[model samples]
Target: MMGKTWIAAAICAAAIFSVFPESRAQQAPASPSVDAPELAALGSYGIGVADLEFIDKGRADPLQGADVPRVADRHISVKLWYPAAAKGGGTRYRTGLPGETGSDVPFEVPGLATPGAAMAKGRFPLVILAHGYSNTPEVLSWLGENLASKGYVVLAPAFRDPPITIRTPAARAGPLTSRPLDIAFVAAEAQRRAKAGEGLLAAADGARTALIGYSMGGYGVLTAAGAPLDPGLGGATRGVLAPFVAGGPKADTLKVADVKAVVAISPASNLYGTPLWAAPGVAAIRAPTLFIVGSQDHVVGYETGVRRLFDQEVHAPRYLLTFREAAHSIALIGAPPAMRESFWDFDWFEDAVWRKDRLMAVQAHFITAFLDRNVKGEAAKSSYLDGLVPNSNDGKWPNAPTGRYAGFSPGAPASTIWKGFQPSRVSGMNFEFRPGEP
Candidate 1:
């Protein structure tokens, strides 16, 4: 909530710690002006990452088949950031970190500092990131950057980024089917690159694909995989003639049989059981799913809302994350606050225990580990995913969910999961963060 001007303040207060190398306490190299993306020690998966763009103009299935195709041979552009040859000189971009952008304020970091863009030499496992409604792929860049930093090819396409020009209601109705087409287009393009020898991202091992989505995108991954996103529930038409944000399969299209796994970040499936994505078929989606929601989030009604969509109905791998003290926005990387128009003072953001970066770590760890286990076939029973381990951090807050989780240890009490009046699942979502062990 503190504007960009605070960066100077955070820096000034942060400066008391000493900037030179040697031993201010631990005796390390100079202080890093800002946290850099951790890329050196990638997980078991290989390394090197870079930016990539694939033609996502797959043809739209004009026919009624559930299969999706786009209108352009080269019209749709799906931008992909994947593990690459850590060697190429990829162009640099501004910090994708949210709030750090410094409101309409001038840049202050000085020097053309750059965060590393990932690139993999050979074919790599692929993960697709879907941004929420009215949002462009750029908004999801933080997630893309995280996974890319960890060595997975991540693709974020602008399926809903197009400008709206509504002429007729039917015209609006026509593209509703385009969302799935957009994702299929992205998948097909990644496959195409492998054939053209783009690298590991191109030659994925089997259908080693994983989808991470939020808000409407939260529904997009489900609908695209055949969950059927019915009317109003999809959140595409927020109000009148608004540009139609692309999305979904009618009902029973892809099936849980499609994606390897899914990480629904604050998905809004308020009407999961109604005519919109009927609970039965939608719940049947078999892939492992990790329903992550911020404790303060009303969007997905916490993970419980997502659980209701499948809870007893699901028969595959499933997990959940409640970023203690996190607001709904924690689920979205690089996105401006989730409920920007709440009319409430923005200070509420800083009042919570889950500071911005800490919440991001909560989101990133669970997601990356989820895919790493399901897609790359990393051993399941991962401490992070199974909760067999406690979340920990090295003073850096990326792994902390709530500020408490910032320094929690495994043997620590579950008390962290219960905040305020004791965390009663019945009372509402948990407002606790458990920093998973590194």
Candidate 2:
């Protein structure tokens, strides 16, 4: 009888192991493809990375109510990437799924950044990066590291969001409030540190700052940039979010001052069958903004979600970049191989029709141009953002001389193809621009 019991246990163990092979071998997955668009290439500066922590004292604790402390300190973990002296070797980041406990997966990304490398001279623009729901900063290393190399101090804060799969509306209260508040707090702290000339951010140019967020992070950055929350949101959180609503006593606290630029990628809004921000709410955003979205994004309805928000923000000088047949997974890096073993994990980083690497590259390219034009005050970069053929497929590139690759489009009369893009590589996309009131 004991032998039979042991046999049954052995069978159960085998079944479990077979379902999750990584549990046994614990092997790292193959690195994602490195192929990138022309402008997605790394900049001249070497990259350096560091991890830091910050605490928001006496903040409301929505996750735990009467039973636990009503107000507790919020601990935020930040992964910072910045310009550094060129160094050998790269960094491999380890991360896990939203609610996964136990094993974390490791994947090496091909890059020039060296962990703990010396900082490069001179102050560079500050960029506050916020990730999506239940996501860690490590997942956004592609953007953080790439921008750092291009002469920016990039900080990505871990919001410690609840799992995306959580169905209860109350489960969202914590993130809905914490997302913007955390971004606002980090921006303020980083600027303060910059002014004081202290720590790794000493060389950061806080005055020339930009906010970039993906999905929920996009929602956070938009609100933090000045888009006020809907009054109805207060009731959803049982008045826990009342103070941060538009015109609320703490409304000012949610905004970052004089934001130079804003980037919202697949931003989440209108998730509750209603718009999170009204026309007046979004009109408050004065910074030049860029909105990127997948036209067919079912996760955050394209027409009802980001597109609606874009249309309402008529007062801001904004541009919308639409991926023809893509989906909500537009902003993340390619799924590491281990994640591909399961549909749930793989969906987090991949799109059904678009290649993740290509999506990332295109994003990096446009974001670079936008930030450079608005934040760095590079007038030359404006050409890259403006005067483009709206539909990429309609753009024309006359045949070039043999033995030479087709060059970037020069815009308008010379070539209709969007500038800085290889001829064959540009398609299935649309770009629109609207100027703010002068």
Candidate 3:
């Protein structure tokens, strides 16, 4: 009887293991020979980081009811990453995730930036990074630090968003109104500091600015880049968002001045049963844009959400990079150690089918190219963003000699593979570009 019971347990264990052989590792084995994408590699400059706090005085708080006597001030926290002289050490950032009991589950991430390091010489383009709802800037330190090394002043704002579990209309209203407003306020403040030659931001170029947002943040950058809001948002936010809608008294405040480029990743566009930006509203976006989303994303959706938004923005030259079979987690880093214990927490930063590091590398590569070409006016970088085979699998490198590894794709008539991408590293993706109307 004892032997039979032991045999049954062993069989059950074997069945479970067969079904989920890689569950422990959570991702496939790293490719042995595939080299990192070209633009994804760190740039020449060393990185520095600092924390800043700003207050938007006399701002209306949508979360607070009208019954509240005084208008509330909006306090924003920004994480600044910039080019700096090479310093030996790095920073380990501590942040929190939403816990079940309405508290935070703290975690830590390692970073390449040296805190309080001396700023590198030269004024660089400003890039405002807006994270997804309830997400911290530390999670996107991957992007912030990488861009800083690449000669950009990156500012990632903490929007203080409500948890995703909160389903009330009131809960939705706060983020709906605050996301874009926070982005605009931060950009304006950063630009002002740059103009005044303020500390840390002294070398920032206010004229050349780019906005990059993921998910809810994606919604923010689009709005901040001059995409008009739907009037329906007013009633949805219980009239709090009315003033910021198109043609409203505060409509102009929603947009950042002189925006050179915009990047929206898995942006939430079709919210509340309608598209967030109508065709006319999206047409108002003049800056060149890049839209990155997973073809199978279920959270903000794919076909009806980001893809639809991309299709509507006809007046802006835009590129859409689709990660086949990937999902909403494409914008963030791999799940931290604390988050890895549960599927719910892990899904926040990792796609089930794609490795987070791979996704981030691809993202960094294209984002660097796009920002360089559009914001810095580097015409040469345009080759990296355009003229690729739409479907990566269709890309051909037919004439390659058998013995040597093919490095970066030569592109065009020489090889159809994407520019700056290694041959083995270029599958499972699609890239498309459309020119803005005259």
Candidate 4:
């Protein structure tokens, strides 16, 4: 079988134009720049980044081939993005994106943040990012960089995944068991190193922390943040798929305490027939959360996946943001130059029902509001979260000017504008909230 990157690129591209051409073409903005719109719209800080590696001695090397000697430990690589002083020259970094075999699509993406730049004054809250299966940290850099600029330290880790041509179920067994464990491990590691003033980690506040995850990552954060797992899950009898089941010998170690908030995008809650997290299981989550998913997500079923997960989290104050007919890629980093080689590759970043830039900008606004309110204790940010309108387009006045709408403008009444959004810029989205049970 082909790599997941290639398979997804091919399958989604055919599905995009055929299923939603009108919607996509209509929403396409006049000129979308290669740069992420939301990344440039926030705070004043320059970004500094560095890479850190950690060894996990408790976990076995799941990837060790039968013929090779068994390895006792697993190593993790993390890329840290933080607020930085602007006195020094910025350095370029590399990234990986999906590409066709023997093609010119480059493996390395040029970085926007400088490497080894001086750390900005004052410690900031920390946000850890975990990406979808077979994806790299660069794929989610849009969020990491933007959050760092907004006075938060962001760390994105590349999870272990099967390489191309090795898509068998056995290849996923190791990563499944290790994904959530990896997240919890990194959270503790980031704080430990930061408090010790280690490398770029010196910029982390560590007092407040949050988790942002997409796809498989959504599963990792949810598990790490205290979602209960089935005691019989992850049993060894299941063979290649056993490592993914919950509640095996390693289940007790997957959780982390004190996560302030969580944002899960298109969470993979039901990858298998049974829900990875049952209602009773998810009810254990204590952190306030924001769940974002497209109503039409094909990869992870909307009703069965994210929405189901959101509904089960009754113990936490939660909000659900639904992109009308958008798909699973609602919040990925912008498409890199390499992905443009084919429509399929481009579909890896573009959503069928929403423009990528617009989707990313909207995500930035809400994410900032959420992190500020929950992680930074900015009480004023509550205005953005409370009393949200169900539909972005419904808040406009009947006779309002063609482009004049409500919800974010100072002059627009609360009834007309979406509480935290600027008028004329918000459309085709829905937001719902459920307060935690006292």
Candidate 5:
């Protein structure tokens, strides 16, 4: 009987292992040994990081837990990554698990949190990064650090959202409703601080602002860029998202005129099988936007959620980049060391069909090109975005580079290669662009 019981346990383990083959395969290599080359900034200047705390007094605690009393004022923490003249060794940044106050565990980054890193000369544009639901800002350090390295100051604000442990869709409403407001307040404060010559962000160029939001953050950026919430969406929120209902007081505070562009990654547009933004509401988003999503995303349904949002925005010039067979979480930095012990935890930072590092590399390339062209007014960069192929793999380089394609050779005839991508690196991606209807 004991032998039979042991046999059953072994069978159960085998079944579990077979079900998550990709996770097991990825976990085999120790994370410390993997090279996250994609995380490195492409610019010549070193990166520096600093934390700023802002107070939104008299604001209701949107995520006040049912078990806890409400707090009148909301305290927001913002982490800023920027270009610096002084070089320093990379350091581990503090991060917390879901719902925790401060992280005891370290999330490694390639930048120093040195206040005296010596700000590089010239005014850099501001890029505010909003993370997914229940996620800390440092998980996106890869983007923040990389953008900073490329002469852009990136600010990631930690939202007072629901804990990751919460599984119910209803529990997400308060934080969901408050996300846009959080971004608006954070951006305004960062701009104010920069203009006032306050602290580390004194060199920040607030006139040029771009928002990059992932998952729920994506929803927030779209709304903040002027996409209105459907007046009827209040029913789906169970009154928790009432403030963001169209024509409500909160909805009036959503738009930010300074935003030059937005990038939404796996945004939660249709949460819990309900539409949050109607077609007319989405059409109001006039800012130039980019959408990055997985074709097989179940969390945010691809057809009805992301693709729908992309197709309805007929007013703005938009681009949609799809990863074939990939799921949500395409823009994450890396799997946190603390999450390595479990498959579900590790998956938060990885994709089943693609390497996270490579994905980030492609993201860095296109995003750099897009933002540089749109926000920085670098008209020359437009060459990289024009004439893109429908499918990444369809773009070919017969004269493939021995190491890297180094982008197209000067004046090389247009081959099948996707704009800005090297040989063989563009597989499994679909990029499309549509200008506003005349």
Candidate 6:
């Protein structure tokens, strides 16, 4: 719960259960080669999806309002996955989730829904996800529907604002106002869809909604926390909000108060050059939070911004965990690369690329633990939050930070290792990753 209106509604919704559902999909095909629960347990040691299909972007450029430019009003897409009513039989393919109507790519999925089948329905907990900046909704394939397989309803929307074609001096000058609100809007709509029964994952309890974001989407979570954002510095970080301000500004406010809790991994905030959780806009978030990052991160370094956010927030219960061998995007699990590349130092603030579904399993487990404890009245299981991350065999299978990959060799005794996220005292069968060419 983050937006003011939504927070109020969420508060009222606490007692009202508005679970949505799409008509049951056609029959499922074959049972997945491996049951999903076993797949999830692998996160205990940081492995990834063995064989999963890609759910591509279904559509693009949705809302076309007067104030919104065509470029600004870009596409929205998402994929819906779950333990089908029956196992699937068709071949499995992998693709990004796109909006229901824009640009897209289609492939085989076991007993997958064909375009007009009902959206989906179930009585599952609703999890609305926000992707990082300049990324389509497909970026975090690591987490989404896989979590759905674990009995949760996952909703991921493409909220890339100002769509980076604004590379020119003139276009770059436009104000970036909608991104945060876009997240808020998407969350609200997900609830509406569930309440109205047009949603993908039908088993949704509107009262049990939670927010999960990465990178810029992380900033959107902060903004939704009912905090206020200050004017930031120039260059890649400035975004669309800078140039639109007029005399004394039109009140640059950001916050979302309805979220019961949030899990932000490798979010970007604070001044690039300076350190500290500079995005005070999210400071007003009084809900519980689970913040994950990498000690060895070079992309959004482990210094000022994200660190300060955790250090200063006093109202809500918050925790931060830094993966030893990981970087900004390494914390999740997804598709293994045909070949590995170390572009950790690539100028992402200025460029863009597709991050595979490497961290989904771990992302799903940690996030599930957070939601269970915070939104579902259960307890969280995190040793790092308790300052107990083991020094030896942690079951975390996170990717090393791009710049930090020493290229020594896989299993070469480097200073870092992970297995299913239990960073200390674990074994190999429970994990996957080779830091160097052993």
Clash totals for all candidate models = 34, 0, 0, 9, 2, 95
Ranking 1 against 4 by TM-score, winner: 4
Which ranking of candidates, highest TM-score first?
3, 2, 5, 4, 1, 6
TM-scores, one per candidate: 0.61, 0.88, 0.90, 0.82, 0.83, 0.58
lDDT of 6 by residue, 256-337 (tens): 3246777777776643343212344455567777777656566656766566666656567776655455566653322122
Compute the lDDT for candidate 3: 0.84
TM accuracy, model 6: 0.58
lDDT tens string, model 1, 286-378? 677777776666646754665465463356556666555555665433223332333332332332555444455445555766787877778
Model 1 CA lDDT for position 56: 37
Candidate 5 on 1-438: residue-level lDDT in tens?
999999999999998887674454333111211222222335777778888788888764435547442557777898888898866665666665541322233344333434547789889999989998777787777677778878899989898576444356555655565677788888888888889988777888888999999998998888888887876656544554467667777776777658888899898886665566754767887778889999999998799888988998899999898989999979876565566666766677778888877667667766777798889999877766677677767665666667743454221264667654545355788988989774
Name the weakest run of 10 consecutive residues (lDDT summed) in model 4. Answer: 28-37
Give the whole-model CA lDDT for all candidates, comma-separated: 0.48, 0.80, 0.84, 0.71, 0.73, 0.45
The weakest ten consecutive residues by lDDT in model 2 span: 24-33
Q: 1-438, model 4: which lDDT tens digit per residue?
A: 469889999899998867574443332121223332222365788877788787777555556657432547668898888888872354444555555552234444444566887889988998889898777886676677777767899988888676542245455555565567689889988888878998777778676889998988888898888886544335421332244335445555667656899999888876554356644777888899999999999888888778887888998999999988999887675566557668877777787668776777777777888999999999987777777677878775444445533323432453455654555666778888998986
lDDT of 5: 0.73
TM-score of candidate 1 against the unseen true structure: 0.61
Which stretch of 10 consecutive residues in model 1 shows the poorest summed lDDT? Answer: 105-114
Q: On residues 1-438, what C-alpha lDDT tens digit does candidate 2 reach at each position?
A: 999999999999999978674432221111223444445777788889888898889887676776542788889899899999785477677666642432444454444467889999999999999998867777777888878888999999988766544356766776777788899999999999999999999999999999999988998999999988988778666676788887789988989976899999989886556457644867788899999999999877788787887887878999999999998888876676677777777787879999776788888889999999999899998888898878989888675333435555566666777887777778899999988875
User: Model 6 segments beyond 4 Å from truth?
Assistant: 1-39, 42-75, 81-83, 89-122, 160-178, 199-202, 231-257, 271-280, 331-360, 380-438
Q: Sort by lDDT, best first: what order? A: 3, 2, 5, 4, 1, 6
lDDT of 6 at 109: 27
